[model samples]
Target: MSTLSADLAHQPGPETVAEGLLTMLAVVPVCLLVAGYGRGVQELWARRGAGQIVPPWRVAAFGVGVLTVLAAEQGPAHELAESSFAGHMTQHMLFLLVAGPLLAAGGAGLPLTLAAPVPLRRLLARWRVTPAVRRLRRPTTYALLAGGGQSIVLWFWHLPEPYTAAVDHPVTHTAEHLCFLAAAWSFWAPVLGPPRHRAPAPVAVLALVGTMLPASALGAVLTLAPAPVYPARVFGADPLADQQLAGLLMWAPMDLVVLVVTLTVFLRWLRQLDRDRPAGLPRTATLPGTAAVPASAATEGERR
Candidate 1:
C-alpha cells in the first residue's frame, strides 16, 4: 500500500497554496461591489414603477457576476491561474462571456454611479451633460469600449511576456480583470442597452456579432499551434491539455451566446418597428415627412 507521506508529497506545495489564497483575496472586493450594486439597482428600479419587478435577465446577470468572481477566487480559477495556458484561457472566457454580459444586463454601471457620494454624483451628472461626455456616451463609443477594447486586450495579453507579467504583478492582474470586465460590459451594452448609452437596435445586434470574431480566431490559432505561446508553463501537469481546454472555452460558447442574443434582438427590433408603422402607408414610406401631408395648403392640394 502507498504510504500517507507519498500521497502528501504528490499534492501541490505551499507556494502554490499561498498563491491561490492571494488570488482569492484579490477577487473579494470586486465580488462584494457587484453584489452590493446589483442589489441596490434592483431595489431602485423596483421602487420607480408600480407592479413591475426586476427582470429575470437582470437577476441572471448579477448571479453570473458574483459566481464568476467566486470561481476566479476560489475554485478552478486558482488552479487555472497556476496551471497552463488553457487555465488562463478559461479564466478569460468566464470574465469576458459569463461575467461580462451579466454585469452589463444588470446595469452595474448605473448602480455604481448612483452609489457614489452626492457631490460626486452631482459632478458626474454635470460632466455627463457636457459636450465631451455627450460624445463619449454615443453608441459607437460604448460598442468600441465593450467590444473592440475586450478583443484588443484578449489578443494583446496572450503574448508570452505580458501574460507572465500579469501573473507576477498584482496590479496588472487587477488591470487584466478590469479590462475583461470593461470589455464584457462593452460587448453586452449593445445587446442590453443600459440607460445612458443605448444603441439603435440594428447597430446593437451587429456590434454583438461582430465582436465575437476576434475571440474565435484567437482561440483557433491557440488550439492549432504546434508549440506553446505562453512561457510560464505549469510545472507538474500537462500544459497542452490545459491550452486546448482554454481555447475551446474561449472560442465556442462565447460565440454561441453572442449569436443567439443577436438573433433575439434583431427579431424584437423588427417586431417593434412593424408595430409602430401607421396602418395606411406602405412600410417603406413610414418615414415622418413621407407619411404625412405637409402643413402648407399648396403642398396638401398638390398631394390630393
Candidate 2:
C-alpha cells in the first residue's frame, strides 16, 4: 500500500505531463457544449422573457455529468486505476453509468444546436432531413443500433488483447474512454433525451432491459472465470480476486441501476395510462409530446 501511494505521489514525469495535457485537450468538446448550452439558455430567456428554458434539474445534471467525466479522467480515480483492476472498473462505471445518463438527461442537444453558428445550425437542419440521417434516427433503428454498438464496444474493450493495448498506449487509452462515453451517451439518449426526442416510457424500459442482460452476462463471465483474464501486473494484490471484484462491481450495481430505471419507467407509463384513461377504455403508453393525441395516433408516432 505504501509503495502504491509512493508511486502515485511521485512528481509527474514528462510523459505523464504530456498525457495530462492531451487529456485536457480531449475534454474540450464537452466543455464547449456545456458553455454553448448555457449561452443558448441565456439567449432564450432574453428573447422570450421566460423563466428557465431548461429545467433546473437538467442543468444540474449537465454540470454534474461534466464533473464526473473530468473526475474519472483526471482525479484520484485515474491515479488509482493505474494499479488496480477494480479501480479501473470504477472509472469506467463513472463514465458509462454515472456520466452518460446524466448528460443524456441534461437536454443539452437542443440547446447546443440552438447555440451553434447560424450556418452550422442551418447545415445541420438540412443534413437531418437527408435520407440516410432520417433512417438512422428512426426510433426502432436508432435504439437497436445504439444499443448494439454499446454492447459491442464494451465487450471488445474487455477482451484481453484490446484491453492490454489500451492500457499500454496513451492514445488507445483515450480512444477507449471516448468510445465508452460516446456509446453510453448514444445508448441512453433515446430514454433520457429532450422530451421531443425521448422514446415512450415503455420503449425506454425495453431498451434498458435489453442492455442489462448483456452487461450482466459479461460480469458473470468475469466473476466466474477460474483464472485472471487480465495481466497480473495491471492489478493490485491478488489479480484474480481483483478481477472478481471488478466483475461484481460491473454486475451488481449495473443490474440494480438498470432494474431501478426500468421499474421507474414502467411505473411512469402506468401512471400516464391511468391519468389519460377514459372510464371504460384501454390505452397504450403515449410519447412525451403526443399525450393529447389519441392512443392510436401516438402508437405509430415513433414510426412517423
Candidate 3:
C-alpha cells in the first residue's frame, strides 16, 4: 500500500487534493450559471403572463445533471480522471449524453432566446425566418454537425498523447467538453424541436439513428479490447479500467437517449400530421375518387 501510494504520487501533475480544488472551481460556476439562468427565464416569462408553462422540474433536473457531472469530474470523482479509461468514458458519457440531453430538454436554448433583449429576440426571429436559416433548418445539417462532429471529436481526442495532454492543460480540457456538449445539443435539436430551423420528423429520426451508429461501434470496440489504447498509463495510474468504463458509458446510456429522442420526434410528427389533416378526411386513407386515386382507376375497375 505504501509503494502504491508512492507510485500514485509520482504519476503526473498535482495530487488528487489540488486537482479536486481545481475541479470544483470549474464545475460549480457552470452549475450555478445553468440554474440561475433557468430561474431568471422563468421569472421573465411569468412577468409576461406566460405562467409556469415551462416545467420547473425539468429545469431543476437539468441543473442537477450539470452539477452531478461537475461533481463526478472534479470532486471525489477526480480520481477517475487519473485512474482508468473506463472512468474517463464515464465522465464523457455523463457530459455528452446524460447532462447534455437534460440541459437541452430543460428548454435552455429557447429560454435563453427568450431571455435575450427584445432587440436581440427580434433579430433572432428575423434571422430564423430567413433563407439562410431555412437551408440550415434541414435535419441533415443538424445530424451532420451533431452526430458526425461528435464522432470525430471523440475519436480524435482518444489519441494517446492528446488525451493525456488535454487533462494536463485546462484550455484543451475545456475545449474537449465544449465539443461534446455542442455535438449533443446539435444532435438533439431536431427531436426537441422549435429549432431555429426545422425538418420533417422522419428525416430527423433517420439522422439521429444514423449518426449514433459509429459512436456506438467505437464504444463497443473500446470496451472489448483487452489492453488500454492510451499511453497515459505509462506515466499515470491505471488506464485499462477507465477506458472500459468510458466505453460502456458511451455505448449504453447514450444509445438509450438517442432511442428516446427518436421516438419522441416520431410521435410528435404523427400527432402533427393528425392535427393538420383536413377535418373531414379519413385518417387512414385518401378519398377513393380524388386525385390521389389516379386517372387509370375507373378504366381498371370497368375492365375488372
Which numbered prediction scores highest in lDDT against the true structure?
2
The 10-residue segment with the lowest total lDDT in model 1: 281-290
Q: lDDT by residue for model 3 over 183-223, one digit each (tens)? A: 76666655553454455677777777876787788888878
Task: Between candidates 1 and 2, name the one with more favorable lDDT.
Answer: 2
1-304 per-residue lDDT for model 2 (tens digits)? 9999999889798778879888888778877877898888777768777546677788889889889999999899999899898999999889889999998888777778889999999999999999999999887678777888888999999999999988888888898999999999898888877767777776777778888899999999999999999887778999999999999999998899989988987998898888786786745565568655656766677679
Residues 1-304 of candidate 1 have per-residue lDDT tens digits of 4798899888988766766666777667776686667656666677775223445566667777777767864687757666666666667777777777776777666667766678998998899899987887788776656667777888878766777778776667667777777777677765674545667777777677667788789888777877666653432266666666777877888779888988888898889887887776532313355654434644556689
Candidate 1 achieves a global lDDT of 0.71
Better of 2 and 3 by lDDT: 2
Candidate 2 lDDT = 0.86
TM-scores, one per candidate: 0.76, 0.85, 0.72
True-vs-predicted CA distance for residue 239, candidate 3, Å: 4.9
Alpha-carbon lDDT, every model: 0.71, 0.86, 0.68
